[model samples]
Target: MNKPERVKLFLVDDDKVFLKSLEIDFLENADFVVETFPTGELCVENLSKKPDLIILDYHLNGIEKSAMNGISTLDKIKAVNADIPVIMLSSQDKIDVAVDCMHHQAFDYVVKSETAFMRLKTIISNAFRLKKVEKELKWYMNKM
Candidate 1:
């Protein structure tokens, strides 16, 4: 894929170590341009910096300024770009919360598991694949 065409991935999580590791993994193994934020606010600020797929953790470490919740962050993000695909990841198995997020328009919900990172990779890949098709269709339509 063209370097410019690589999917841009934004990560919002409290865990710095984990986020960094994920960045390294995506850089080395996946067809993504990864940007990870240790807090939700920074991620929100960077949304306009670039736009693509997003991976959000349910519980963030510093959320007081941001209402300290993933859903709130999601709301803020959607305010800016509703069509951006966001995969919400939570260690908690709160069905209600997941349902609420979905109702609010989350693309997908994932509970932390043994291979959560791998699952994230799959989700990103699938989303990008679909986006690629959509882009091609739009181009063809414009040409026609």
Candidate 2:
């Protein structure tokens, strides 16, 4: 039997305790490779190492306190790697914010919940599988 691919997820949240708790959950239950950063700036700085997916909070402390807000951080990341999937987490219920995030090409926007976490795991696994197949097919085509 073949082993499953482990999903590499980078989590960015200003709340240190939240990040630590998520790191624990990802390790203990989801079997994912989780790296936690207290802020998006650090995550972006280290992203040259490249993570398969990113989980970001909508409101981050110490980020640009401007009209753009989370979109600014998201923009910085997307600029470097347009294809890297990003999932947004927010406690806010404002439709405008969610709409703007999705409009900016976030893979998904989610309000944190137990169900959401499980779904995140599933999505990560499926996305990895899809990307893997695409890579294989591209290689085969190049050889042909």
Candidate 3:
């Protein structure tokens, strides 16, 4: 018998408090290895670590006026590795914003609210399940 690998999650948010709280929640509740980034730039710089998923704040420039926004960072991340799933997390609940993130290939968009953590947990589980199925399909195809 072998132990399963823990999921590696990269959480990028300019709000330090929100980021820390979310990180703590994930660490305490899930079998995840979490990394917190205060800026999208820092997340991009650490992409070499190859996190399984990323939860990025839509408004990343809140703390830094000149920082790259979530969409831009998302683009950079996709450019580096399109396979890595990224969930756009934002305070904005507008449909247009969520649509924009989906257009940019976000795995999903999560609005900041009391239910956010639960929603995120569900999304993460679904994403991983899908990824596993995809991989198994690819393997079967290759065998055939």
Candidate 4:
């Protein structure tokens, strides 16, 4: 018997405290192989590592005044590998912001709140389940 591969997650947030807290939560409660990035530029640069999922901050320039924002970074990630699922995260609860991120191909939009971790867990599970279905469909199609 073999252990399943852990999900690799890239968490991109400019707020050091929030980023660390989220990282710790996932590490302590889940079996994720997590990586944290303070700037969206760094996350974009490391896309070659091929994370299974990305939770990106909406305002990535909060600390780095000149850093790429989450939408910009999301665009870059999609351009590199559109198949990778990205979940846009923010402290804002604006509908417009959520809609905009969805327009950019985000798998989901999560607002930072007490329940965010639980919501994220559900979303991550759904994303991987969808991917598995798609993969099986493709395999069957190829067999035809």
Per-residue CA lDDT of model 3 for 30-98, tens digit only, reads: 999999999999999999998999999999999789999999999999999999999999999899999
Off by over 4 Å in 2: 1-5, 62-69, 129-144
Per residue, candidate 1 scores C-alpha lDDT tens digits across 32-126 of 77888877788888898776988998888543545457887888889899889999988888999789889777888888776888988887778
Candidate 2 C-alpha error for residue 5, in Å:
6.4
Off by over 4 Å in 1: 1-4, 61-67, 133-144
Poorest 10 consecutive residues of model 4 by lDDT? Answer: 61-70
How do the residues 92-140 of candidate 2 rate in per-residue lDDT, one tens digit apiece?
7688888988988888787766566777777777767877898999999
TM-score for every candidate vs. truth? 0.81, 0.78, 0.97, 0.97
What does the lDDT read for residue 5 in candidate 1? 78
Q: Give the best candidate by lDDT.
A: 3
For model 3, the run of ten residues with the poorest summed lDDT: 16-25
- Tell me how many residue pairs clash in candidate 1: 1
